[model samples]
Target: MRRAAASVTIVTILLLLTGCWDRLPLRDLQMIDVIGIDQDEKEQGVTVDLIVTSLKGAGKGQGEPIAERTTLKGPSVIEAVGKTEYMDQGPFLAVNTRAFLMSESFASDKPVEEFKFLLHAPYTSINTPVIVYAGKMVELVNNKSSNRQAPIEKLHNFIKSLNSNGVINNISMHEFISSADEPLEDYPLPVVRYHESKFQIEGAMLFHSGRYAGKQITNEQLRMLMFMLGVDQGRQRITGSVSDSKSGLQDITYGFSVKNVRRSVHTQKGTDRLPMVTIRVRLNINVFDIGDNIDTLKPNYAVVMEKLLGKQFEQEAAGMIRTAQQANCDVLGIGKHIKAFHPKLWKSLDWRKDYPNITIAPKFDIQILNTDGFEQFQ
Candidate 1:
């Protein structure tokens, strides 16, 4: 009797259950693969470009392509999205969207804080990779690859490569928010440019206090910066001459690749007068090429590599400090260091006011772990 009563109750609950209230059928919806945001030259407002992908059935004798695209634009992102509603299709869904490309002009003029509202919207995904382009968004979305993968997938894979290789700082929505909120930290966004047949990562956009600070760093300098911050993953080729132990007058040329980098930051308290900041870096390397053989190279290789690396590291550190000082931007988290070590002093002095004058000391130690082919020469 109890089982019969429970079955009746379960059937009643099942009868009340229905499909999602806001769900739209896939067949009746226009699927958007890419969204572009830029400044509208004619309207003095933002322009939203939607790239819609549709599929048509193949005829009996023909094999049709799987996807087709159509574009729609409007003064606002939402309006541009709504323009597709009049189509025979029921609605447009961007939840499956893979990429969002913003023009440099739009990103510079519109602070990211203004766009945070979109995070609350139902369709946008937080993990959707965002790319800032110096050129038009249309050009980016229309890019075709010789490879068979969809354009969106190709672009997403490229971004993943850049992040894993540490070529540029990967600035996501969460990181952007944290940097913007912190008083001491600044944000850097990867910059992209379209040149001829290919797209290239130009460098990074440096931001200070929620505004576009007028400072940009090149890819080479960015790599060096990442090395100092202990994020080095990309390949580096170094060429230099080292002195032979037996023959002081003879110089041997050598080249190597950096396999890994580890770094840490230290701060010395400021008495009522001065404060000091020190950065220490350790590098692991592999020798790939040698121009000449030095029998004594094995023992002295560490010393020579350390000196060369120390000089290179110092140059990069000084350049970063100068770049931020000139723009009055603090992207390195120097303020956080001060706050962590000397809270009382950090509270008394404003970092922004004193950052331009602060002194920095950088030290580096390079270790050669394995020589890929130097064993033959030895």
Candidate 2:
């Protein structure tokens, strides 16, 4: 009798359970893939473009997925998004957004207010890639790949490759949103240009205090910055002349694939009453290429190559540091490190006012781990 009563009670409890009470069917929702934000030609209002993708059959298996383009304009981002309710399908879903593309001008002029909506929205994903493009937001969103893949998909793959190769540190929505409020740390957005039905990542735009600093760095410089910032060491490659040829005809240029890197930042108060920072980087690399000439190899070649590469890297790092200082971009997060480790020093100085004036020195130590001359063939 007790077992029968217990079974009956369990059945009653299961009957009262409510599962997904407010869930909406997929057929009733609009799925957005990419969102583009930009300012109007007059620079007085916001324009939003969305690439909405939805299956035509709605699970009936009748046709291919369809992509619809929609544009909305308003004086602000929130208003533009709100306009969707009146003009388009109800309850839009953006959880699958692959990326957010913003115009250069829009990113430069007061972007914090424009970005607030995305941060507060419940449907948006924080991991979406945020990029700054050179051309019209509409054009970029409407572009189609020759291979029939979505242009935004192609762009996302390109960014992913750059991140995996350690070429550039891809910035996500959460990073961009948080950096705006972080006083010491800044962020970078990969710049894209669409031409001839192709999207190419040109360089990167540096942001300081949530605003574009009117400064851009070349793609080559971006790679060095990635190492300086101590991103994950992927299959990174660097090329430089390690030594001159035996005939003295020209410099022997070689390519090196970085295997490991150890970087450290030291902060001190200089005798001149200024903040001093020293960045030391140690790299372990393998010789990736040695050209057609095998006669260039000599006794103690690895040691000589290490010294030459280290010197060359130090010079390049110094120039990169200067560029960041000049642009007032603390992309290396030196100020953040000082704040965390040296709170007293951080309290005594205004980082924004003194960052450009601070003295920063970069040092590099390169070690060639494998120069067996077989890498060229491999």
Predicted model with the maximum TM-score: 2
Cα deviation at 112, candidate 1, in Å, is 1.5
Please report the TM-score between candidate 1 and the true structure.
Answer: 0.78
Candidate 1 lDDT over 1-378, as tens digits, reads 999999999987886675567765444445555567888778866666655554445346543233334455666665655565675433345434556677888778745664554556565555666677788877765674322244655566777777777776566554454455666667567787767755679877777755678888776556667776788766555566655454352455667777778888887755544577787878777665544353235546555655655666577777876886777777677777778878886877777888777776667787766532343312
Q: Ten-residue segment with the worst summed lDDT in candidate 1?
A: 369-378
Q: Report every candidate's CA lDDT.
A: 0.65, 0.74
Report the C-alpha lDDT of model 2 over 1-378, residue by residue, as the tens digit. Answer: 999999999988886774455655677656666788899877589998877776666776554557777787889877777777676555335434777888998898978767766776756677877888898887876674322265766776877887787777777877777777777657677898878876788888889867887788877667667777766456677775644454342566888777777889999898775688988887877676544334354437667667766776777777777788888999899988998999898888887788899999888777766555534423
lDDT for model 2 comes to: 0.74
